[model samples]
Target: MTDRSHITLYSGGHKGAESEFGQLAEQWGIQEVNFSFDGHTSIQRTRGMKVLDPEELDKGNVSMEIVSARMGRKFAHANKIRKVIQSIFHMVNNGYHVLAVGWIQPDDTVKGGTGWGVELAKLFNRPVHVYDQERNGWFTWKDNAWTAEVPELDRDTFVGTGTRNLTAEGKQAIHDFFTRAFGPA
Candidate 1:
């Protein structure tokens, strides 16, 4: 078996996929880092939580207009969402592989801030995988398109982010993914 202890899961520690991923990582004896900031209160995973200061968060800052243009959606609360968008940057920047569970919009972006993380992964040319709940399958970004495939966590560090509304199927997929990568925990 692979030494899962060496693996580190970077995430936002949200209620849905990130929490599930963190739980699985703990079960598998893998390391986990859940990034957060001041005044943010929805975090579920406390282990390895690295709260970022204002300056640290600024390093990941980008114009909200650019984010809106890229995601094809407008943010009603730009100020509130800015911190989240910035925090996602640290997760994607620290991880080599990105695995997310969300709805992949027709616009080729995974919905919400999770999409921002996915976009960064693509920009960095890191391997990105998304398990679309609606599609009920995993799709990996390959050659400028999302192709169907069963992905393995070959890297020592990876980011896991997705929607807060976790589904039964989504949870199973995360479990199966961990099992496929590290065997029964």
Candidate 2:
């Protein structure tokens, strides 16, 4: 098995998928960095947590109009979501590979805030993977289409973000992913 000591997982450390990723990263001896902002209370992983200040958060800011257009949906609480979106930018920006656990909508976008990170990964041309909970399979973005594949953590740094309402399958997928990449944690 490849040494995973140097691998770092960048995430938002929310309750479900992100928290599972963080926990698995710890179990596998991989470094983890969880990005957060003020007034954000849902973070589950505190290890290596980096609370982004307003200025740093602003660095990742984009117009809500652009985000809505890109996401193919509108945010009712644009002001509240802007900070989360900005923090996601930091997670995606710092990580080279993006792995998400969510539903891939018909529009070819992963669902929820995780979708924003996936979109950014696509726009940045970084390798992106999604373990669709609904589909119960892994898909990788290739040539503008999501192709089925068993993905591994090929990069030293990667972003792990996904839905807050993670299912048992999603949790197992993250565990299996780490096992496949690192073996016997």
Candidate 3:
């Protein structure tokens, strides 16, 4: 028998996708690692989450406010984003096939970061399955099946198999690809 390959699933704190992914992980016995910076703690603090300090999350945010802070803020944000992307890339490079599951919304800030996950998957030659918010009819196909509309990060990458929900076919594809790369479920 071959080894069961490990899959490193990249995720964020988006409640909806997080919950869905957490459920799937529970069902499948898959492990997940989430990457995040200070803002998460600050948001939680302001909202009175008692798990950790309220001030920790504000470090990056406060550094963004230093005098003549425009450039600092931009670089700080860019650096954080770069770190997050790098973390994802490192996980893939370390030989675990990745499953990047998270939110992709219409807002520009959120959308830009969503693309990073796609780019990371492409960089590692892995498949990225993006789950979007809107339940639109556009993703529906004549196959009488619906899927999430997944877009490519660049031209050289595998344009994802868009399925609104993770259909049995989609799951089979994932299972097959990973099994080929690693081994059986």
Per residue, candidate 2 scores C-alpha lDDT tens digits across 82-129 of 999999999999999899999999999989999999999999999999
Residue 14 displacement (Å), model 2: 0.2
Instruction: List model 3 lDDT by residue over 1-185, tens digit each.
Output: 43211433334424433334433433444444443444443111111112223343333132223311322224446545544344333334432333433333443111333444444444455544444334321221113232454322222212222222444443444444344433343
The per-model lDDT (C-alpha) reads 0.93, 0.94, 0.35
**RMSD (Å) of each candidate, 1 decimal:** 1.1, 1.2, 11.1
Q: Write the per-residue lDDT of candidate 1 for residues 54-133, one digit (tens) a residue.
A: 99999999999999988899999999999999999999999998999999999899998889999989999999999999
For candidate 1, give the lDDT.
0.93
TM-score of 3: 0.39
After superposing candidate 1 on the true structure, give the runs of residues whose Cα lies further than 4 Å from its correct spot: none
- Note the residue pairs that clash in candidate 3: 38-57, 147-163, 147-164, 148-163, 148-164
Identify the runs in model 2 with alpha carbons over 4 angstroms from their true place.
1-3
* TM-scores of the candidates in the order shown: 0.97, 0.97, 0.39
User: What is the alpha-carbon lDDT of model 3 when measured against the actual structure?
Assistant: 0.35
lDDT of 2: 0.94
